[model samples]
Target: MSHKQALIIYNPLSGKRKKHSAFPILLNKLSEIGYHLTVNEINEVNNMNNPIRKACTQKWDAIFIAGGDGTVNQTIQFLAEEEFRPNIGVFPFGTSNEFAKFMRVPNNIIDVVSVIESGCITPVDLGKFGNRYFINIAAAGWLADITYETPPFLKSKFGELAYCLYFFKKLLFKKPSDNISINISDTVFSDLSLFLIMNGNSVGPLERLIDEKICDDGYFHLLTYKKTTRIKLLFHLFAKLLNLSKDLSIIQHTKINEADFMLPESISLNLDGELASVNSSYFQVLPQHLNVFGSNKNN
Candidate 1:
């Protein structure tokens, strides 16, 4: 029998304190499961000879990603362009690691290796907005700016809390305003403070952003917050986050297979957790498009 070939692309700077310790454990366990492993440590972003690019040149049975959402998104962009894509195994070793959290991938290296060895794979959905693909979320409006606006230094030092601090800073000082239009299922939302199209319920540290379990459903969860006062919106958001409120009337949500948005040139769209360069306003969900190593219970 031919051994299954696997490639590991990991960001050297991610989860610095834990990654070094986890590295050897990851290699030994996967090898035990009959995978011939080739490892690549990422030192810089956009290196033409990056591991993701290298993985594309060969027929890898699986690709293990060890980083945050931004790193995952970069990999998705490259893989989506190929006709034959390998299954994904995620190691949550970066700030927030929202995508891995959504996958219910355990943070412990030992357990993560077990999941891969279990051979349980889930067919997951991916969202295509303009030219890029996202597995977790595609968002825009009010607070979405925090994704890119927070300095890298802050993210590196404080992790997800840096985004929270920046959020409140913008909330107290900047008025919540946006000129955008969303059309889904023939319904139009012309005025929205913020909007998110989520494949999973978790975003940043708020685990139940949608208050329900989201899975590989064929549709995206479209959550749109109507225009409202900054202070009022903040309180309501907190209420929802804390599970104090089951429903917020100002926030309209529904399941959608596709949607279109008219965004201002000044407004930046956040894909996963990074800034998205999208020219087209159209967005569509490709159901069960990718196979990921995750348990079905996570859904």
Candidate 2:
């Protein structure tokens, strides 16, 4: 068989300092593996979409994204629109590679490259929120506000710790809203505090926090927590930290293909890691929309 042309789009600012140091070694290994590869280093954030367009216009077998969730989100926005979508290969150099966890891609560069060269592909689902596409979770209410409120300097220095610190800070000052209503298919749930819709199994580093049930079965999980006091919120947080499902008493969980959230007022939403908000929002699953290059593992 002829060699496949691959394009590697990476962000230099992602992952740990040590992981970033492995780039040259990864490049050498890719060369040794006989892939006709092109490497594009992303300096500015706006430069992300341009490379995807350039790669699409050329002859390439796969587009390898080597950054965090934000970079992957940007690349997906472009690829999902194209008439000819090439296979997507992921190098999880991001801080929280939630999508990579769902796809079961190893964190090591060599192992990831081996999976890519293995030539295996699988059809996975994608979530659509308004006009954008999300591969992991799209969250609204408290979590969204916390993510947006996090400082860039903190994020740059501490990575995922920024989110943790922000979460605690929000818990002290921010009160959960009780005016949100969630409509999932035939069921209508009123008086929700938070709405977390997940397309992947894991939300962050810990696997069992969100939903440990069924993640990649071509459906999105709808997790809504009832409005409660800060004490209850603390309990829930502890439960998430401990991976205890029984402590999730305030949370209502279900699976659905389509859902809508009607909020009493405008609120922010977090898709992957990007932030946005609207008074009303709609979500639907794009069954098998993303052709991810990875192992045959069932998410």
Candidate 3:
């Protein structure tokens, strides 16, 4: 078969300076591998989706994104809605490229490019919230509020540490509100503190905190927490910090293909890494919605 044409969508702000410098070398290696490559930088808001849609119209074989989870989410949203969906690839340039971890893509630029040119494809499930798409995790309540309140500068300097710092800050001041209700696979639960819907095993490379969650399982692992004492909350936080999911008594995990949340107050929702405030939200799993290009043997 002829080598597939690839469109690379990248976020220039992702990663450190050293990783950014290696982009040219990666492009050169891809060119030598008999694949036609087109690269575009995601500079402004909503810039990533336009090029991907245009590439689909041009009949490209695959769309390779070289950013963090948020960029990958944007690309998937476009592909999932398009008439012709192309294969996908992730270069893992962002701070926490969780999808890349699921696909087993190496952080090294050369290895990532080689994996893409190898022409392997895996059909992966995607989670949809309203009109957008997320491939890693969707969270709401206190966690989402903290994510939105965290400063960009802190994230740039400390990466995942920003999340940790913000988590403590929110927990100290924010009271657990029982204003939310969740319906998962027809089972309904009311008066919840927080809810995390995961497409992957872990949220990021923070394996110690997020646990070992798999992405290709065709269903979402939903974790919900009820209002509890401060001491219990502290213990649960420590358990997550140590990757001890079983010890965290405050958390409840269930698997479902679809879920909806009704909240009395406006709650912030984090889809992948992007944050938005919504009063109510619905999430559904779209199995095999994306064709991912990577080095996994099963694919």
Q: How many residue pairs clash in each candidate?
A: 0, 0, 1
Model 2 ranges with Cα > 4 A deviation: 41-49, 57-59, 210-216, 240-249, 277-280, 296-299
User: Per-residue CA lDDT of candidate 2, range 1-299, in tens?
Assistant: 36667778888877555568878877777777777778876643244457666666774778888888877887787777666677898888877777887788998989988987787787878888878888887887665566546776676678789889988788788777656887766678886777888875566766665535444577887777777786886578567657665655677677888887786656667888777543347777888776787853654
| TM-score, candidate number 1 | 0.90
| 221 Cα displacement, candidate 2 (Å) | 0.9
Find the candidate with the highest TM-score and give its number: 1
- Tell me which of candidates 2 and 3 scores higher on lDDT: 2
Query: What's the TM-score of every candidate structure?
Result: 0.90, 0.86, 0.86
Error of 3 at 233 (Å): 2.2
Clashing pairs in 1: none
Model 3 Cα lDDT, one tens digit per residue, 1-299? 36668888878777544567877877787778766887877654264458778877887887778788777776776677777778887887776677788778888888877777677777788888776788878887655566546776776788768778888887788776555688876788876777878866555545524444555667978877766776676578557656665753577778878888886656667787777544347778888777887743334
- Pairs of residues at least 3 apart in sequence or in different chains that clash in candidate 2: none
> Poorest 10 consecutive residues of model 1 by lDDT?
42-51
Q: Candidate 3: global Cα-lDDT?
A: 0.72
RMSD of each: 2.4, 3.0, 3.2
TM-score quality measure for candidate 2? 0.86
Q: Candidate 1: misplaced stretches above 4 Å? A: 15-18, 42-58, 246-248, 296-299
- Name the TM-score of candidate 3: 0.86
lDDT of 1: 0.80
